[model samples]
Target: MAVEVKNSESQAKKRAFLTPKRILIVVGVVLALGVVGAIALNQLSKNPAFCGTCHIIKPYYESWKNSNLLANKHAAQGVECLDCHHKSYLEKAQEGINYITGNYSEPLEKLTFTREQCLECHEEDYEQAVAATEFEESNPHDSHMGEIECTQCHQMHDKSKVMCSQCHTFSWFEELDDSWEIES
Candidate 1:
């Protein structure tokens, strides 16, 4: 009887090392904490301040905050960096890796958006945009040179200019809304 009781006690000790329930609970807790941490990091990274943390991105961030370019104007109207520069989770993660590894191009590549991308938040199409500027002396939206890319005249980082001013002088551009700058 004593021997049988000793064997039973030793077996119980071995089984108590980790029951199935305990292992499942531990895994669940770890996964939950990981998810919570990821969520917190993602939310915190969305701020302009976070992007400014990267030395290469500091100039862009500053332009967005202080310049009269479309970046500052858009930020004033409550638009954020990620709002237009949408990227998937994997893409963002890859960008982070590249930033850390110093494997990115110098003077980060400029992003050019299409008319459709512009229309995502804009209520006006090309014709509507032309109509909106009809009161002005010249209609840049309806260029005789064919449909122009919005980014040509509506630069976000650097100063924006009147595309038509390359040859034609729309002197009223500067006085219009301070939106377009004189070409250098």
Candidate 2:
């Protein structure tokens, strides 16, 4: 009877605690949880408010709230930060790491988008935008400067300035655009 008890105890000890089936189940559950967490984070971060959570974004976020800049107009038409930012996930991750490591510059640089990006919602193409605004005298879209950048005239966070105003003596304020001479 003593020999039988010792043999049974040894057999119990030899039995593996984590079988291959149990390992697979644990791995599957962890992967599922990770996927769900990632989805939740992505959805929550889509709102511009999420960008405002960071201290560095305070100025831009505040501008969006009360300022009558182009940003507010875009927001009114259902455009969000990510829509214009268009930064890749990897680039955004690196930006966060740089912020954490204090390896970034102050007075955050203004982000620029391609002409195609602007035309995405504003018009069908650059020519279309030009035609729409040609009713104005100067026709900023059809400039002699040859392919003027939209950002040069249409700032979102700061005051917008007409590029032509730099060279021509246009009677306008700092926040003026092509439609400065609207005949009321």
Best by TM-score: 1
lDDT of 2: 0.73
What lDDT is obtained when candidate 1 is compared to the true structure?
0.83
RMSD to the true structure for each prediction, in A, is 5.4, 6.2
Q: Rate the local accuracy (lDDT) of all candidates.
A: 0.83, 0.73
**Clashing residue pairs for model 2:** none
Best by lDDT: 1
Error of 2 at 51 (Å): 1.3
Task: Report the C-alpha lDDT of model 1 over 1-184, residue by residue, as the tens digit.
Answer: 9999999999998799679998899999999999998788688778978888899899999988888778998999999899998978788778889999999998999989987788788845556777877645677777888876788888888878777778877656656566566664
> Using alpha carbons, what is the TM-score of model 2?
0.70
Put down candidate 2 lDDT per residue, 63-133, tens digits, no spaces. 77656777776677777888878777678768778878987778787677766667676666567867766
